[model samples]
Target chain A: MADRVRVKSWMPPGHIRTPAYLRGKTGEIERRLPAFPNPELLAYHLPAPDIPLLRVRFTMEEVWGADAERPEDVIEAEIFAHWLEPA
Target chain B: MPHDHAPHPYRPDQDGPLTEAQVTEIAIRELLIEKGITTASEVTAEVEAMDARSPAQGARVIARAWTDADFKARLLADGTAACEELGIEMGTLKLVALENTETTHNVIVCTLCSCYPRNLLGLPPDWYKSRAYRSRTVKEPRAVLREFGTRLPDKMAVRVHDSTADMRYLVIPSRPEGSDTLTEDALAALVTRDGMIGVTQL
Candidate 1:
């Protein structure tokens, strides 16, 4: 089976890489990126640690439900590991 | 046609006092110069180099992919490295080339901010950075493409790549039909910035 993941719905203050629109959505991992420094910490000048990055692909139906323009369409976004959990 | 309109709203940057962001930018640049971290000439040269990059670079890549199947495979596999192989410096920008096929159309947008493939395609266009383009593309992409005069059939699936984080996207638009006999340079000439951005098809 393909790897499935869910984006965390946490709404914390300060610099965030996960967009609000993508929160709580489930998607398949399209590709994995080489680890990158956590921008949330880097933005505040904190010592940052590297974390896994993923390009997740979500269908329009999954994101917008009945309101989707074309339910079969898809949207892909880069989400950090901290913002994702195995689905 | 030159004097069709009477007048328009004045541009703030040209007439009004500098904004806080502008002031901060100037202050940092001045500080860098004072500290000898960089020179004024270096800054000018950097700007010149940036301005030199245009859609032409992207056009060249698309044309090559259309003509060479092996190059297209390499481009799809590793966008940054493949671009470097063509003498295009990708810098630190991690690139991913999204291919448009017969059944799918790929469009790129940054809902958070304008995260573009700048090194390869120069600066993002003004419309690409607009609040409307950023917000609506993901919500009602078909309508957004319609505004750009692109009307895809219902059978074709649209893939909107919201470049929210690290990775940048470049749409490898499907090669137009009936251009097989044309030279690679001629093929490159047919590619346009908007088409590469996926707002319109070539």
Candidate 2:
């Protein structure tokens, strides 16, 4: 079964991995990627703990709504675990 | 405002005017070298190594994949290892090859920054780093692809891969039709940088 999750809309001020457009958007988890040090913290030269990353898939309609050129098109993004919440 | 006429520290003919970011980079580099963090020769060697990569390397990989089924399987399964089969050193970074099929097409973008498969395809083009391409590709890919003169059929599904993490993506474009008689070298000649990036098809 695919894990469905929504990106949390947390707008912190700094270098971020998650794109702003995908924030608050729901998507299906495609697969789990290997864990890596938190880039958000790494950018600041802080000790960054390892975090799980997931490849999430969302339809064009979900991201752009009526403005989407092709509603059936799919987009995948690599998002860290902490940025996602169960939809 | 008190103005003093002084010769600029930067040699006009050799260095030109450095941007603030470039000046900061120089400062950091000099500090690191001064502190014995790294050597100037090490930095120069790294830059030269990066400069050696080009799209031709990627084209050769694509050509081999087109002709060899087992190689193609290995490429799709583990891109980094597959590249090594042809002696293309991918270093420690992970690479994923997305296959374009009859029903699905793949495009790559790094919305947060200009992350790319520099090991295979050299430095990314200026347009790829532009704000318009970065922001618009995710929102409206079809229009963007169209602008690049790559029009897909309405039935074909477009899949845009956002390279947000360390894993770099390389699009394995479908082989062109009616080229069965061509050699691997000839077929490789047909592959373009844009084709590998999924902005256009070969």
Candidate 3:
């Protein structure tokens, strides 16, 4: 089970960890990927997906900052359940 | 009372900026050596191998993904297996590959730290690992893309995907149109390192 969130808008700071670079964007849910447990935890120390997730889509101009001359671009993207607040 | 005896300088609450895990990492490394389970030399060798292999491998994967559609499809389905097929081997890393199509583009960044698909794309470009890139990519994705010379339409949809937890992501860009008749080698040649990151097309 996963939570959902509707990200209204993004304030892409010059730098930070939040996928703000991907904010104000939209894409289709391609497929559910995997998940991760709290990294600080011990016992089960592996890089396997502990939970399920969904990937999305975007264009180069959407995420990478492309110019107009060379257009018609896109990129495959993924977002986890943990990352969403609520839509 | 004599102005509170000369008034203390207004030093903003500077709590000696060492509470983060960086300090803990040093402590852990010292402890590891003290326990004799490992030596600094052993750790350094492994680190060196990882460092040396990262970027070159990334360039190769980016180049390969750019030129191979079947390979790209496999990556979209199962990144880990797809990587192994390429001889890059995702190994213990839970890999995920994303495609930047004519409709969408993708970029990756670790806001907390530089969590990248080193095994596949190799070492991340400095910008991809930067805090600005990470933060802005999600919020002002279009603006960021603009910096990269990528601009989307007002009507065109822009989606931002965040890479978190065990799963990592790779951007598989669409093959450029004029590249239809080119050989795989030639196609690979046109795949810029940035293309793999979804910053630009082939």
Candidate 4:
């Protein structure tokens, strides 16, 4: 079964992989990606640790509400594990 | 495109004093060379290698997929490995091949920054790196596609990939109708960089 996830709405000031527009939006996991050094930490040359990444697929309706051009149209993005929470 | 006319439209850097960015670049280059980190010849060679890349490399892959079903399956399964199988150096670039079907159209964008399959398609276009294109592609893809003169039926679902992380995205555009009998090289010639980017169809 495809895992359902929601992007966390946090806006902490730092280098983040998640887009602002996708905050608080829920989507299905399209696929799980390999772990990589977190960009948020790597950006500052901090002690970077590997983090899991997932490609989450969100429908236009979920992302844009009534302003969506079509309900079925989709948007997929790679969200770090920290940015994703179980919906 | 330069014209050897009396009036030159472009004033190259030599026409004026070096800009701050250019000066900084020269300084860094000199320091790096002095420190034995890299040589000017290595930099020039790297630039030459980059210059050797173009959309033709990507077109070859697309054309191969069009003519060979097995290759297309492999490409969809693992884009980087599939490209490497064709002797294209993908380096550490992971790729996801989004196939554009009749019922759906696929487009790629990096809303965070300019993430692209540069190895296959060469450099990303100037418009692809602009904030307007980045923001609008996710918000209003249909409108942006219309601006590119690509109009799909309202019923067709548009899938936009916001490459916000490690993997770069490429749209494998469907082969045009009535081109089944064409040779692979001929079909490759028909493929355009815009088509691979999902901005236009061949």
Candidate 5:
């Protein structure tokens, strides 16, 4: 009997999480954040909830202006969790 | 086991004095702690700190945007950086800042949750995080701003930005002329937290 692997990913629809500006707009994966159960899940079971995870740093040009007019434009943002390519 | 529509023992009406809103919050917090999303102390502490910070800072940013073109340009280019240049400390990640300029007035809403620019303006206002504001701001911005006591000129355009991710937006309102004599502090005083959210004007 093989154990089941839940193909759960954090970035998905219906989450009160990150803004649209940060998603699907590929940038360097910068770092791998620690994983924790989702907030909605935790809120379903706990008295108080805290989100535990690592943060990724993204430069501004990578976010708003990979296509922006000014090349010198540099801004930064942090996204939670890293997407893992299928094995 | 098949069809139990009966209320749970923890249902809102069963609780005393607490509104459905209060009950929902209690239940949600319980679930989060039970599931290890966050600890109670951390949530409580952070909420307290956020309440203490957002408004005053939001006021300052709005005021500067209203008065300084160079500052406004820098803010539009890189909001977090612009704030830091003005001495606002921000977390390097989990935050997004957007600017609303002339020919466009930007208003932010977090439909999923209150994903706000806590660094620049502090936490979002209660209305901004409300369902009514969230739903209508995008679909009927003029109506929404009207509720906030703002009546946009017929020619001006309103662009609503959703803080659908961790990203947030700050409204850089047009500067009010004849304010040349106003000191920075006085100008900042005119900048309301609501002004930054684009619900009201400074």
Candidate 6:
């Protein structure tokens, strides 16, 4: 089963791990990585809960739209589970 | 058996005044030393250790992997352990080698910061640290790779790995054709920093 997900478009202030451009972009889950402490909370030296990290794969066309040089190309990013929603 | 030498005059302005960041850094270091948290010699030793590392070390590893099949398998299996076999200390950071194949390609970038395998490949290039590269690479990898003069076929899949956490990635570029007869030293010579970073294809 392909776990296709869309990156949530949330802009919170202060340190964040997710990139701004990936907001609302749809991609497939490539792999599941070991859970890591949420960096947003870790930055403040607070105890952070471990979150599932997934390697998401997106076609260049999906990410860059028509501006993509090679539409067939793929880009993989490790995104936290909280930032993902079903596409 | 001593010869008299004239003492040079001290010129305070020979070097420009330190910037705000530099002043803050110096003050912090002084405070740390005054509090006995660390010594100046210890800091100097750490700096020297970092200075001793360079990309030549990574190139040597790649050359060996290209020549030895078992080594290549090990590298692909566990990058950190494979590098340790070559006497490269990875410290606490996990290093993963992304092999480039005919159907797939891999590139690495740190979107949040300039996170790189400095211990293996030395200091990153200036352009890699630029905001343009970091911001644009994720959104437009194919265009960025093209700008780097690495144009792949339209059918090939380009997988971009974002170094967002503790793990670091290194690209094991495809062995150049017609170079089977080259010695390991010669092959290592062909590996470049950008190639390992996946900005350039060998």
Candidate that beats the other on lDDT, 1 or 3, i.e. the better one: 1
Q: DockQ values for all predictions?
A: 0.88, 0.80, 0.15, 0.90, 0.08, 0.63
* Residue lDDT tens for model 4, A1-87: 239988889999988888999999999999988898999999998998999989999999999999997888999999999888888
Per candidate, chain B TM-score? 0.88, 0.87, 0.70, 0.93, 0.70, 0.88
DockQ of 3: 0.15
Candidate 3: segments with Cα more than 4 A from true spot: A1-30, A39-87, B1-35, B62-68, B153-156
| True lDDT of residue A17, candidate 3 | 28
Interface RMSD of 5: 8.9
lDDT of 2: 0.89
Query: Residue B40 CA error for candidate 4 (Å)?
Result: 1.0
State candidate 4's DockQ: 0.90
Q: Candidate 5 chain A: minimum summed lDDT over ten consecutive residues — where? A: A1-10
Best of the two (2, 4) by TM-score? 4
Instruction: Give the fraction of reference interface contacts each candidate recovers.
Output: 0.91, 0.89, 0.18, 0.91, 0.11, 0.66
TM-scores for every candidate against the unseen true structure: 0.91, 0.88, 0.62, 0.94, 0.55, 0.86
lDDT scores in order:
0.88, 0.89, 0.59, 0.89, 0.56, 0.83
**Per-residue C-alpha lDDT of model 3 across residues B56-133, encoded as one tens digit per residue:** 454455556766668777877777887787687566877766666666666665555667777755566667778798
- Per-model C-alpha RMSD: 3.7, 7.7, 12.6, 3.7, 12.9, 7.6
Between candidates 2 and 3, which one is better according to TM-score? 2
Query: What does the TM-score come to for chain B in model 1?
Result: 0.88
Interface RMSD after interface superposition, each candidate: 0.7, 0.9, 6.8, 0.7, 8.9, 1.8
Q: TM-score, B chain, candidate 6?
A: 0.88
Tens-digit lDDT track of model 6 for B170-198:
99988899889999999988887788888
Q: Write down the worst ten-residue block by lDDT for model 4 chain A.
A: A1-10
Q: Model 1, residue B49: what's the lDDT? A: 89
